[model samples]
Each structure stands twice: as structure tokens, then as C-alpha cells.
Target: MTLPTPLTGVVPPVCTPLTPDNEVDVGSLTRLVDHLVTAGVDALFVLGSSSEAAYLPDRHRRTVVDTVTGHVAGQLPVLAGAIDMTTLRVRDHVVAVTAAGADAVVTTAPFYTRTHPAEIATHFREVAAASPVPLFAYDLPVSVHTKLGADLLLDLAAEGVLAGVKDSSGDEGTFRRVLLGTRARADITDFSVLTGAELTVDSALAMGADGVVPGLGNVDPEGYVRLYRYCRSGDWARARAEQERLCGLFAMTAVGDPSRMGGSSSALGAFKAALHLRGVIDCPATAVPQVPLSSGEVERVGKYLAAAGLL
Candidate 1:
């Protein structure tokens, strides 16, 4: 596998703002990108899970890629996530985003099928071959249930396709194993490993993770930047403190339902609403079936943001 150059810093999986009519809000997107850049975010990852990528259509997804890349310019590297389950469709998305000037592609493992290790390798191999830019192996086994084994990663590294893997499974043991196995290897020139879970970001950094890719950064950009810088600087105490504050803002994501804070339509809506309240964007809307946050949820999230000094 082709190793990605050492990628350091906190890269947020930014959320996509939408118009009331369910169309992508280019204006809001520009505002959001500007907000993140001004807040000192290292990079912007578009069309990620936090962005509701799975619910977006191809046309809108392409528009998001162009909007984010064009707005960010070359100030920060912009990586776009490829969410289509079909390899052919994902390949097409990679080609599309690459043409749109994305720095790289972050793709999840196959979702519909129970992908075996071998199939995962094959899938990524095909996607890497088709993608003009490098591909980041997305390992969100919680959502897809296919953990990217260390042996498979080593094998893929041997084949020279992947740039790195995003370990979002939140399995510390698995993460440690991957790190130990890949750290001493000299064959994988650019294999960078990124931690995907937000709660474990500080711990992941302390464990020598290449970088952090968290969803919470979409709303609390400055807090995430501060937390990440602290971690990268090896200040666990300050990092932990900032993480606690970050978690407070993240609490707003559970305004409607505390049990399922993330991956909920309302939670995402709450995040966008919080961003809107903070004046970063306008029109806090979601796609079909998932409307904007309820009045109470919005109020709660707004209050939470205010408490966190974000609004």
C-alpha cells in the first residue's frame, strides 16, 4: 500500500448546510469554510458522516466538493469522503471529486455486504486504482461491521494502494495493534493512521496517531483546534480539559434523544442549528425525512452552545 505522507493536526469532517428547499446552500458552505479556516482548523473533510453524506445525491455531493475546495482554495487540504456502497459508484465519485480538486478521498468499507478481509482488500484496490488522488481507508465498523484487520492492512501496504486507514471502530486494542504493527515497517512509505472517534481523540494522539478526524469539529471548530494543538504539543492535561469542554458542546447533539446522540437525524440537525446560532451559517436544514431541529431541541442546543462559549 502506498503510504500517505505524515498527516498531522485535527481534520474535521465538516457538515453540509442546506437550503430550506433541500438544496445545497453554497453561501452557507462558504461561510462554514471561512469559519473553520479562521478558527485554525488544519483541514476540511467534506461529505463525511457528519455531513450526512449517505443522504445526499450525487449531484449535490459533487457540488459540495466543488464548493468546499473552491472556497478553501489552497489554504488547507480538502479531503472528500466517498459514501456510495457500490465500488463502481464509489470509483465514479472519486473521479468526480478528484476532478473537482479535492486533496484526497476518504472512503468507508463496503456497507451492504458482510465484507471479508479479502473482499475489503479487493474493494479498496479497485477504488485506489480508479481514484486519481490518494484514498484513505475508512474503518467505521460500528456502522459497517467490517473491521479492517492489521494483517489486511499490512497486506494492502504490501500491494501499495492505501494511503492510510481511519480507525473509527473505537477499539483501543485494535488501534494499538495496528500502530505497533505499522510503526516499525519501512515498506509502507506513507501509511498514516487517523483516529475517527471524537471521545478517544486525546488518547489516540497520545498513542502516536498520525492525526485526528473527528465529527465534533464541524460545530466547535475552535475548541477542536485548541484540543488538537494541545494534544499534538504533548500536553495531555490541557488536551483533556479542552476535550471536556468540547464534550459539553457535543452534549447539544443529544438535545432531543440522549440515548442515541450521534447518527440521529435530529442530532445532526441540532449541530447545524448550533452552527447557525453561532452565526457561522444560515438555514439549518437537513435532507428528506430529516427536517430541521425541533423548537425545543434548537433552544436546548443554543443554550448549550452559549454555555460552551461557542454561540
Candidate 2:
């Protein structure tokens, strides 16, 4: 299927299923993909933050994109994260994932070094020019350390340098500003604005976001799909209910003790655990350097799933 002009609906940043040894578990990954497909998600995103792209080496990254895109066989658009600290590095990922059959590439602004906004703009332009598929900006200020200002994103979108943006900044003011800018621009009809804020999905959709890229959606994609459909159909009451249930499930991210692990480990581990508990993946092991959730934490995630009716 061709990517929609403004890609809409729930596009989960799929968790990368890995073996106990940290290799790409292709069989488990395929099962996870099938699970998402069965849940009616509009698209799949691989090698993203939720997929541990930051920790994955180039080889595993390629395997992920190749496996997911090849498995889907064009049934859904596969957006791969071409993430790196510099333009050249990110461009290389773009080429590799594109060659591996990704439908589009999502990248963040330069990181690990202080960069002027002009340089950031140049970086995106150069990367977009080199990418074979459409490019989407990943606005994740927490990770990248540079907020993608609304004007800059809109400017790039207006210039056709970006096909869309997945705003994970957790800044409602700026997200709304970007949405308003897109709505105000006559030339920005086909640009997508997706929110990664799991708890505020209903509010984001009500504020005109085109879609959501919730990491939690990886576990309960059916819920996000239902929320999207409810919002699209103007069933605000039902939309809020679904959103609230997902919010309850999202609390599982807090199950891991903060002193033992950072939010990435806790949240990602909870997600993988839930996927494992749901029988979507074989193992819930996250990449190295990130602390693993204890059995107690995993049990807590199961409780959240049960409370959300996912179990």
C-alpha cells in the first residue's frame, strides 16, 4: 500500500524483539509484527527509540528494517528510524534502511554536539535530499537536547524537506503551535503531525494531530486503533474512555524502581514484558547497558495489562 499523503491513525514504534543473546529474534519479531497487523494499526515503525535503535549496531538495525518491511510485504507502510548524531551518519542509515525496504525515514536533529538552528536546518535538508523515501522529523527534545521549534519544523515542511513530524517532545504548547501552523498553511496539506505522548492522545487528536506514535501502542495496538477510530468518528466520549484505559496501562512504565534504572529501561522493559505476557514476542530482554526489569516489575506490568483488559 502506498503511504498516505498525511499518514494517519496509530503507527506504533514497534519494539525490537531480541533473543537472550541480544541478536535480532526474527521469528519473534515476525510474530510481533503479525500482532500489530492484526490489531489494525495503520503502519509500523522499526528501529526507533521504542525499538532500542540507539543501542542497536548497524547490522541489527538493517536486520530489523529488512525483516519488518519484508514481512509486511507492503501491506503497511514501514517507517524506519535513521537516527544518529550527525547528518552523514543519519544519511547512511537512511540509505541502508531504504535499501532494506523501509517506506520512509524518521530522524532527529543533530545531537552529542552543540548545533546552531541554521546547521540543524541544513542537516535535515541534506539528509532529506539524500533519502530515497520521504523524510519525517522526530522531535524528541529530551533525547536530542534540541527542541525543534515550531517555526523551523513548519518552515521545513513548507519547503517539502519533511513529509511529517512525530512530536515526542512532551510540550503541549509547542505541539499545538505546530498543529496550528499546519492548519494555517495552505501549502501544508499533506504533512503529518503525530504525537508520541501516550496519556494525552485524546487531547492531541482533539487539537488536530493527524495521528499518534505511542510506544504503549506496541502492547495494546487494538486500544489505540479503537481510540483513533473513535476520534475520527467524532465519538469523543468513547475516545476519552479508551484513552483513559491506555493511560492506566502506561503506568506500568513506573513499575521499575528509579534508583535501579532510568526511565528508558523501565518503560521499554515494561512494554516488552507486556508484549511477552500477551504472547506477541518470545522474550522481553532489552539491549545492554539498560537495566533489566526484575521479575516483580514484570509481574506489575502483567497486572497493568490485566487491569486494562489486555491479558
Candidate 3:
């Protein structure tokens, strides 16, 4: 399927489901896809941060893309993340996911090795040249350790090197600048600027963002969809209410004790737990090495769900 020129609406960064043995749970993943699609999301983003793409092995990544793209069957755009440490490695992932039927590929700036802005621009251009499908830059400085500059992003957008960007850098100032630049620059057209921040969807949309790629959307797709519709219709009052409610639900990510587990363990574990409690997926287990949420923490997740009326 051809990606929407300016992809809009709620696009959930999907969560990967795993079995006890740490293998990809195809059945659970399919159900999770159905849950999101049925909730009126515009597209599905697999192998994103929410999907634990960084931790997934190459084989597991391939299986995830194949499973989701096959199950979606063109019902909506299936964007797979070609997340890696550098240009060449990201290119290989791009090839793998596109061959597995992904409609587009999302990638972050090169990491682990220190890189200059010139090298970052060169990296994206090189990957875009090699990719068989549309490429969306994933601006996640928390992991990549380098924030994307709005000027550089706009320059690339003008040159057609990037189809869109998923900004997860948590820099509202830069995010708003990019949004405004995308709108004001005559040279940059048909570029989709999506937010990967869950708690700021309303503010992002108000700032001319094209859409949202909220990981929390995996747990409460309907809420995000409603928030999107409210924003598009100019219902600020209703949109704010819904967004605040969703933000309350998002507090589940902190249910796990910080001293006991890492951020990935707490956030992803809470999401999978919510999905399991909602009966959308079978198992709530995350990948290996990441600690599981304690039973009490899982209960805390349930409380958040119940408060949000997801239970």
C-alpha cells in the first residue's frame, strides 16, 4: 500500500508480545494488531521503542514484521523500524523488513560511535537511497544520544530524503519548531511530522503536528483515536479532557518499582500487562533480560486500567 502523503491520525507504536520461552508470540501479536486496527488507528508501527525493537534479535524482528504485515493485509500502513547503530546496519534492516512486506521503514540517527551532524545527514541520505520504501527518521535522543536539528531535518525533507519523522526526543521546543518549519517552508511539502510522545499529543497537534505515534495507544487506542478526532474537529475542550484522561492512564508505566527494574521493564511490562488484563493478548511477558513486573506492580497496572475504564 502507498503511504499517506501526509500521514495523519493516531498511529500506535505497537508492542511486541513474547512467550515464556522469549520467542515471538504470533497469535498474541495478531490479536494486538486487531485490537489497534479495530480501534480506528490510521496505521501500525512495529519494531519501534514500544515494540522492544532494540532488544529483539534479527530473526525475531523479521518474524514480527512478517506477522504484522501479513495479518494487516493492507488494511492499514505497516511501518517497520529499521533501528540500528549505523547507516549500513540500518540499511540491512530496511531490506529485511521491506522484503517481509513492510510499507515503510523508520530509523534513528547512528549511535554508539560518536557522529557529527554532517555524518548524520549523510547517513540518512545513504539509507534513503538504499531503501526500497519510504523512510521516516526516528528522533529519539534518549537512545541515540544526539538530537536532530530542525534545520537539518527540513533540509533533508526538501531534498526528499525523508518521508516523515517520529520525534521522541522530548524536546517540545524543537518539536514545535519542526512542525512550524514543515508548514512554513515552501520547499518542504508532503512531509509527515509525527510525535512519539504520549503525554503531549494535544499540544503537538495544536502546534501543527501531522499525527501522533503514541506507545500508550497500544493500551488505549480508542482514547487516542477520540483525542485525534477531537483535535481535528477543533474541539479543544473535549480533546483536552480525553488527553488528560489518557495521561492518567499512562501513569501505569511507573507502576513497577524504579529500584527493581529499568525503564523498559517498567513501561513495556506495564503495557503488556494491561493488554493481558484486557484480554487482547495471551501473555504479558517481555523479552529476556528485562525484569518482569511484580504481581503487586501488575495489580497497580490493573488499578490504572480500571480507573481509565479499560477494565
lDDT of 3 by residue, 91-128 (tens): 99999999999999999999999999999999999999
- In model 1, which range of ten residues has the least summed lDDT? 257-266
Worst 10 residues of 2 by lDDT: 1-10
Give the lDDT of residue 296 in candidate 2: 92
- TM-score order of candidates, best first? 3, 2, 1
Error of 1 at 168 (Å): 1.7
Given candidate 3, what's the lDDT at residue 186?
A: 94
Q: What tens-digit string does per-residue lDDT give for candidate 1 at 131-236?
A: 8777888888777777888878766865778877788887888888878777777776667788987777788888888888877787887787888889878788
Candidate 1 clashing pairs, residues 3+ apart or interchain: 1-157, 1-160, 1-161, 3-190, 3-191, 4-190
TM-score of each: 0.93, 0.99, 0.99
Clash pairs detected, candidate 3: none
Query: What TM value does model 1 have?
Result: 0.93
lDDT of 2 by residue, 9-62 (tens): 999999999898999999999999999999999999998899999999999998
Give candidate 2 regions above 4 Å deviation: none
